[model samples]
Target: MKATNKTEAQRIAYFGMKKMEKEGGYAFTEGTVSNWFNVVKEQDGTTYGVLLLEKRGVCNCPFWEENSEFGACKHIYWIREELAKEADFQSLTETDPRWLHGGGI
Candidate 1:
């Protein structure tokens, strides 16, 4: 969902991106369904995990639970951006042959 307050969205996205980069957040799993994103933040060496859902970037972060009724939180925004970049890079490489045909699962 789009934010009603565009300025707020931009501001949050900006800070989120910065914190994500600086803190080395966004860790994925190592399994067949590799869609889990553990957005982590380390404060005083204490790491906190914000689980990002596979669907629609919904997160388990308290900030998201409270502030994302209408719009996405910074974690979601940052994760979306990262996912988009991965998608772009994958598009340039080999993909599932089924997708090339008309029968992707």
Candidate 2:
């Protein structure tokens, strides 16, 4: 299924999170670059790169390549949530363009 809007992408991300929890999929930042992350699928050792841009995220994963114009993929969603927990991002509101669109990264 293709995600056609932010809401649909969020729904997709929700299911992706459930699968990740079940399969031990995980993601971590690369070096000191807060905007760069490597998402790994533990079950297969597969890795995809996710780059947070000023207004959107780009992931090398096929799903993201196909659906990114509409909204974020699971890796993007996960990283955004992780970043939100960091001190640097704590002051931003959910609706802030920098927060919602990955601008301040």
Candidate 3:
């Protein structure tokens, strides 16, 4: 489903969290550089994930490329909640990533 607004995106993020938890997913954060990581599952003997922080978030996963324009992807949503408590990313610069580009929220 496509998220038309911030509220909808948040709702989707909730579901994503649940799914992650059920699958034993986990995440890590680096407050200094504003980097967040999601411990992706093993697929084809490889472990990979999405990285989010500061003013931009990006996921190498296909899901992000397809659904990012609507709202923060699952990995991004998780990282946002985690970093919200530890970092002050309110003053991002132009060099930051463009994950929150359209300004939905």
Which one wins on lDDT? 2
**Stretches > 4 Å off in candidate 1:** 1-10, 30-36, 41-56, 93-105
lDDT of model 3, residue 95: 59
* RMSD of each candidate relative to the true structure: 8.4, 8.7, 11.6
Top model number, TM-score = 2
Model 1 per-residue lDDT tens digits across residues 1-105: 344574665577568777776767355332234455555544434322344565545556655555565445666677677677667556653466754653333
Question: Over the stretch 1-105, how does candidate 3's per-residue lDDT look in tens digits?
Answer: 566776676677678866765775464534444353644454433333556646657765555665676545666766666566444455555556642563223
What candidate 3 gets wrong by more than 4 Å, as runs, is: 25-38, 42-48, 80-105
Tens digits of lDDT, candidate 2, 4-79: 7878877897688566656665766574576788877766788888888887888887778778776577777777
As for candidate 3, its clashing pairs are none
TM-score of each prediction: 0.50, 0.63, 0.48
What TM value does model 1 have? 0.50
lDDT of each: 0.57, 0.74, 0.58
Report the Cα lDDT for candidate 2: 0.74
lDDT of 3: 0.58
